[model samples]
Target: VWSREEEVRHGTYRPQSSAQLKATLGKDGKISAWRTDYVQSGDAEGETSFIYAIPATSRRHFSYQSNQRDGPWRSVNSTQIGFYNESFIDELAQAAGEDPYQFRRKHLAADSRHLKVLDTVAKRAGWGTPLPEGVGRGIAIVESFGTIVAEVIEATVREDGSPQVLKAWAVVDCGTTVNPLNAEAQIAGGMVMGLSSAIGEAITIDKGAVVQSNFNDYNILKLAGAPAVIDVHFIESGAKMGGIGEPGVPPASPALANALFAATGKRIRTLPLMTQAKA
Candidate 1:
């Protein structure tokens, strides 16, 4: 005998744009030009306008399974996310009269997931606490692999634009943790992987051949670049372990990005921060 089951949940929220500037208001008290269409107007005069539009939409799906007739079940999941195009960001920037990063930060602050991660990191890293001048700190987190993980990284940068990984702390809640040691290792390994990506490592192609062939050119984390401290804490629950394989990968990238921003006053958007370290 064989049996199978599947369940899925999805949702989307569209935020409406605010009204245009009062100075640019039409006779009917409504902004006629869509925020996305304002650039063509070339209203470079003293007039400024505001309009709201959707940038990008996201969809998520989750799944679980039970194969045995009387044993425990397991879960397998994935997510597909799409970011807004440059035009969407430009329109949003024009409407808010602020840079895209600032606007996105404001919008992300209102998201429940982002807020949860931010709050957790703030508490974990002692957000308002004092620190030395050369020591820089950053925090970020994400939801994936059926769990939520938050990470905070501390580092220092030299005049030549190289970043040193000093320490990292992570918190995860994926229901009940099946193995404490494994969980700790996963988080620690994740931090090192994140560190390597931030400081060194890249893939290149030349003459239709992969330029970087071995670990000599494509470097992983070395002992010197590894974090001296990695802490992982889990919230206990009677439920089963929701995820154990890849949940640890997402938080470190963003945390490293935030750290780079603090250390160098440079906001990096591309992958492998080392590639743009000089930029």
Candidate 2:
């Protein structure tokens, strides 16, 4: 399961009247710049977590969305911002003796929303097409925050013994998309962010403090290690407004892990696949 708090800012600009503008301008006929800063801050505080049963047959995805101030926010937003707990993937895969990607796809296919995302990503990623000798592809999807997200990752091992994320194809359905450009950016950004976690990032705890204090230890994927391409597609069902905040996280880790399994015979059970690949 996952939990988060988000604060968003919106600003509006209004031009002052001619008299006010003239009063502010200097006698030299050049207007001096006067600036006033205003802040409108809103806080969204809530907890969302999920649990899955063994055999991976039973899955529960739930979340709650409430503002610091009083008033009902739409259920659509609430559903889109809930928790996604993936702890059951490993246990279920073990129980079925099946690949995690296959298991997840099988389960997700039962839901219409998830199925649409899977279909779109598969088509975009060329799921069944052949690849070079060392290349492999893996795919996974999750339903969170009223959105269904699916991702396909291609990975390979380089000569220096490092795993590389070559490309990522992502599909998301957040009901009716408000802005296509922003939506595309959101998905692409999420994939890159997830790539960081998959390849070379971690936060460790020791004794009672965070042991990895700086970027030296808390690494992120750089331009050299970043995926060459991330393709994002959105499904417009004309249903309702869904989520855009965090639906991008769940798919990348597992997809990258599966891709690593293809590049190497090893199945990655933990995150930061680069660490294990190097070892």
Candidate 3:
């Protein structure tokens, strides 16, 4: 990940690119048998650690090389990571000659809770249904801050190299949801922001200041570009309570990316779709 730059004094330097990451995913599409290498690119701020949520019979490993800066921030960055990781997973599924939704469902069998959301979202999005050429449906699932969110997006790729999202469906399991209205709004807001970033939000550094200062330069999802329909469903699984704020964001970006790949047969490794693959 590349960090932003800021200056405290003229002709002086302050660096933020303090951490670098490399990861490898193994076959079978599970988090098992994978490795991640992280290096600290600057002065040491604190110690680094690795956390894994492996059930029995799992084999996932990670390594961290730290000089130090600060721990990675959540919210925004988590969405980016989800976009990168889940998109790659979809590619793997396609390479294996399997439907992306079914591929993920097969791998997530261990966690019935996760499967619940995945199955529900896919059903709501009409998974396995036929679509016109150049149109595709994509599904992605993420657990953020203990809340599990699964999203499915329907999108079409136009000849002009632009992608238009048609509809979005989400199934969130945050345990017993206290307030249904608030949870739905939270999830919908995350989906909008996530789609906006995936479609047209790019940031670059020049000298030491941000090149795009305002919305005019940093384009966002306009009314016409936003999804025509969005459905958010909550599952009262009676599990442990979880946060609803950020969980919805991660799946939004990845689901959109996967849908684009399905439509165009091209993978997008970078944000702001136009950067790598056109349309």
Candidate 4:
């Protein structure tokens, strides 16, 4: 679904990606192995970010795009890779005809920190609980900068097919939480940024120069479009401290995408969903 022409790109420093992922499942419908090939280029090189597995058997290969104009880079390039792979995991679950949340539980190790955090978000969000018609819930987990974070996003599609997020539940296990309040803020801010990037932000070029000079075209998330509630929880797993700031951003996009898919039968394989999702 992600072709080069469909790749999001423009005059901004933001990167672009082309990804192809394939997996094999056992007779039990559990993912047995996978091979992921993705190419991404930004102002700097971005390798594959992260993947989740129990008995790991997967390979990911990264390549640089020769055409990008180099500038600066982001510390959380993992967000892009995490978004790609995590969404594919949900796709795998759907192919197996299993519930996405429970499917993740089956594939993730039972006693590991990843599962613990995943379970926490599901429980906190009341996974499998009834929702008002037209509302759908999506769950995603990602580990970036060593921190494991899971998120559940509840949203519904507008008449125009744009997703309107209603609520968010996030759980993180990054070892020690020296300051609970600040850590919570970090996660919340990152999640908001991630959602903004996914749902509304886009860049275009005209005559070798960037277009969309004002908010009219270059839109960002507004308060009305934000989730009504964001609940953040922390888990100290007594392991080496990972990171709090960047980990929160990785899982937000995938969770929202999955939520929108649940709300509408259409899957999101494109960004700036405000424009692309109408189809």
Write candidate 2's Cα lDDT for 254-273 as tens digits.
67776776667577655555
Best by lDDT: 4
Native RMSD of candidate 4 (Å) = 5.4
| Residue-level lDDT tens digits of model 4 in 162-210 | 7888999999998999999999999998898889989988777677766
**Alpha carbon lDDT of each predicted model:** 0.50, 0.58, 0.69, 0.79
Cα RMSD (angstroms) for every candidate in the order listed: 14.5, 20.1, 6.3, 5.4
Supply candidate 4's per-residue lDDT for 238.
Answer: 94
Ranked by TM-score, the better of candidates 2 and 4 is: 4
Query: What does the lDDT come to for candidate 1?
Result: 0.50
- Using lDDT as the yardstick, the better of models 1 and 4 is 4
Residue ranges of candidate 4 with Cα displaced over 4 Å = 1-12, 42-51, 54-56, 65-75, 275-279
Q: Top TM-score: which candidate number?
A: 4
Candidate 3 residues 1-279, lDDT tens each?
322222211222212221222333456544443333222233222221112232323222233443223344335345644654577668767766788877676666556888888889988888988998878788888776778888999988766777788999999999989999999999998898788877887655577455765566767888888889999999999999988877788788779888877877777766677544464
| CA deviation > 4 Å runs, candidate 3 | 1-32, 38-76
Deviation (Å) of 127 in candidate 3: 0.4
- Candidates, ranked, TM-score: 4, 3, 2, 1
TM-scores for every predicted model: 0.60, 0.64, 0.77, 0.89
